[model samples]
Target: MSGSFYKVECPDCENEQVVFGKASTEVACAVCGTTLARPTGGNADIEGDVLETVEAR
Candidate 1:
């Protein structure tokens, strides 16, 4: 599947961030420095609360 953007809420500080669905690197929360997603072979492993899936415009 193609990569997409997702709005994620940090579990630690409730900070929101947009992250790539298929990110090849670790994604961290900008406010709290918490890990949000990890790189897998396919889709990224999401660790934060997913708010929504953003559509590419």
Candidate 2:
């Protein structure tokens, strides 16, 4: 099954960006360069607010 995409809001800047749920590497905010998610060997550990979840089609 395909993984999901998350709409994350940076806690520091409130910048919104799409991040892979199973991201292997660190996912950073585009505007503020804040860590949005980090690899956890499974699903990434989301560091900010998850505004939405988009399932892969």
Clash pairs (backbone) in predicted model 1: none
What are the runs in model 2 whose C-alpha is more than 4 Å off?
none
Ten-residue segment with the worst summed lDDT in candidate 2?
A: 48-57
- Backbone clashes under 3 angstroms, per model: 0, 0
Local accuracy by lDDT, each model: 0.91, 0.91
What local lDDT does model 1 show for residue 33?
Answer: 95
Estimate the TM-score for candidate 1: 0.90
RMSD (Cα, Å) of model 1: 1.9
lDDT of 2 by residue, 1-57 (tens): 468998989999999899999999999889988999999999899999999986664
What overall lDDT, based on C-alpha atoms, would model 1 receive against the true structure? 0.91
TM-score: model 2 vs. ground truth? 0.90
What is the clash tally of candidate 1? 0
